[model samples]
Target: MLAANAEEAEKFRKETEAGDYDLLEGEIWWRDRHQMLIDHGYQLRPRLRPGWEPSWNNSNKNPLYCEDAHVGLRLAGGGTIDAVRIMDGKDVGIRPIKRVSSERTIFKNLADAQHLTGQDQHIAHILDTFEDDRDPDLVFVVIPLMIPVWFIASSLKTISGIVDLFKQLLEGLSFIHSKNVAHRGLWSYIMLDAPSMFPRGFHPSDYFQDHSGVHQIKVLPPCKASGPVRYYFADFRHSIDVGQDAKHLIFGYEHPVGADFDAPEWTAIGTYDPFRADVFIIGKIFNEKFISKYENIDFLSSLVEAMTAKKPEARPTAADALKRLQTITSTQSFFTLRHQLVEKDSKEPESLLSENINILLDVAFHGLKIALKMPSRTISLVRRMKRGSKEKETAK
Candidate 1:
């Protein structure tokens, strides 16, 4: 297998030198390593032509090089299709044993979490692993392929759709926390779905052009789906086990920097409860992505606010947030209520007032409470203003 990989790499190198394909240094390295996996009985689909490439430089000569290629893999025994995420082991800055140990820990954490949650559908499962014989340092982790949540959000027709998706995510998070795993990185891209058709790659330069000219660069559109969607959390590279106690603290500056949804605690100088950080991450997603964009579902404002509370201790547990979601879904029925109110208000103002008298009464009740809380002088001033306004109306 080693000799075969070396031969293939030499062949590819010769082909590239002959001007057959303009391959980058990282691309050449990936092809060479991938051949070894194939020799070990792993069947990979044809390289998706025009596949997306990371914008960052990945040349072997560059000190900051890293591989971010995504490829489809046929699971052994033809059970299911999965993705192979190829990582350059050198970039992690850790010994091979420690890195492999971390991978084992993640696998165990997910396995235990699945059992505790009864094989929850919202968590992405790892299928297999492969070690590159050619580059003993490179690791290939296999996981289910999924569509990004942002793409699904584009097709959402109502606030109710968004709520249902979020509910599933909260349930998944609750289960993950129950098993003492902290997904330090929780964002929209982390949420994904298994769709019917595999996505085809396209060159960004084909669709987008600058004044200079079209620069042919491969990229994949965000994944999309047509029917029912099941959201799952993926990318567990940053995941950590906090133990079943839920209060276990993990210290690390490991969270992705400059991520919009990253928890503020991640930037602190000392140890922090990762579970609480997870809550903040989810809350930031809900607050910025869903609630802020859609005004009709403003009822969720308080829930997200509580989840993203500045003080870690003040933030609700994932389980508490899940329970709150259930209550909101059952009681408020905001989508239906919002539509009805809009229709009624548009068709007949008087009928709308009569039908929603309770809403008006509630407003007045709160106003009266505010008035009662004011000082005597403030109350007297309000009364004088009211009388003055009435006199002006009478004069008119």
Candidate 2:
């Protein structure tokens, strides 16, 4: 759900409080943390009532033990453009960091990845950091407000649209891997719409209202030209640097289990290449979300199968996977073949002559039934004509 308007959010809060719903343990934690952030000059946007929930890993049984909290926020001074802070009052996004070590690591990883990617359009840009003065554990990281990829995918009307999104994700992942970073947690939920475009079909006035009872209208940004929309990879909390050496082993004995996205190798005993695990995550996502659903996108079938191979060694490197994707997309004949197959499958089989004859007889029977009622229709029309003539003659 999109962020709620101020009035709606306030009403929700009041209702929750009145009903004693605000006293729930999760709600209490959220309220306290939220107030702390507000006290430190970070202004959060009104959250959508039904959709906003505590960001907790399913593996973690305790609701209060949250490592990261997702919320819509903005800089106090205003919007910052291109790394420079400005005062335009635009809404940004924030993800709270619960652990001091995790916060430091994430900040460093984001900065290093940014340097490596360097204005690459597919990577989510981290804007700045926020910290609470009183609490050492509470830290907030700011980023551009992005529409979720699942939201965008649901709106997509064609196979080509899904392909476009997948390609962008591959490109971003390739870049990250090239920089020797492994995004341990890569899934469809972590992908987001590009910052350059507004939320699909959104209007500012829909969320904002004039208070003085006067009609207030404002111009909105121009719609972007129709093309492949850009997508970015977000949520770097589980990310790590793998260093320059490709053979460098990273141990994952302490890695949490039970999540579907967790690479199978992590659960097995010894050290594993984090980069290969990243590829496995991406492959799993592609196979489950795209390949399994759409038959025409069989071009990616073999590639996805290989990337998701049970053995970590069998999976392709991110760079190799990207190269294969480029090759498949560049082949125009594959798309032509796919179109032909889809068109052929969509065509209905020819009906038997007996069926056609039955249809014709049904049409004729209906026609005769209508013809039987024509005399009454004609009588009504003649009476109406006579009545009109009498009225016209009287008027004359």
What residue pairs are clashing in model 2?
none
* All-Cα superposition RMSD per candidate: 19.6, 18.4
Per-candidate Cα lDDT values, in order, are: 0.55, 0.55
lDDT of 1 at 104: 52
Q: Which ten residues in a row have the lowest lDDT in candidate 2?
A: 75-84
lDDT of 2 at 120: 62
Where does candidate 1 stray beyond 4 Å? 1-21, 40-99, 115-117, 186-189, 196-228, 244-246, 252-254, 334-396
Error of 1 at 100 (Å): 1.3
lDDT score, candidate 1: 0.55
Badly placed stretches (over 4 Å) of model 2 are 1-42, 46-86, 112-117, 194-228, 252-256, 333-396
lDDT of 2 by residue, 1-396 (tens): 222465654554454446422233433343455555555445432232234543322232222222122121222122121111234555555555654665357555656666665666466667667775456776666666555565444444344556666677777778777667677764544655443433232221121212111223221211222223567776665677667786857886745344557788887788988888888888888777767765567877888888888888999888898888878877745233223122213434443344345345545575575566579879789899999999999999
Give the Å error, residue 101, model 2.
Answer: 2.2
Model 2 residue 234 CA deviation (Å) reads 1.9
Give the per-residue Cα lDDT of candidate 2 at 165: 66
What is candidate 2's CA lDDT for residue 385? 100
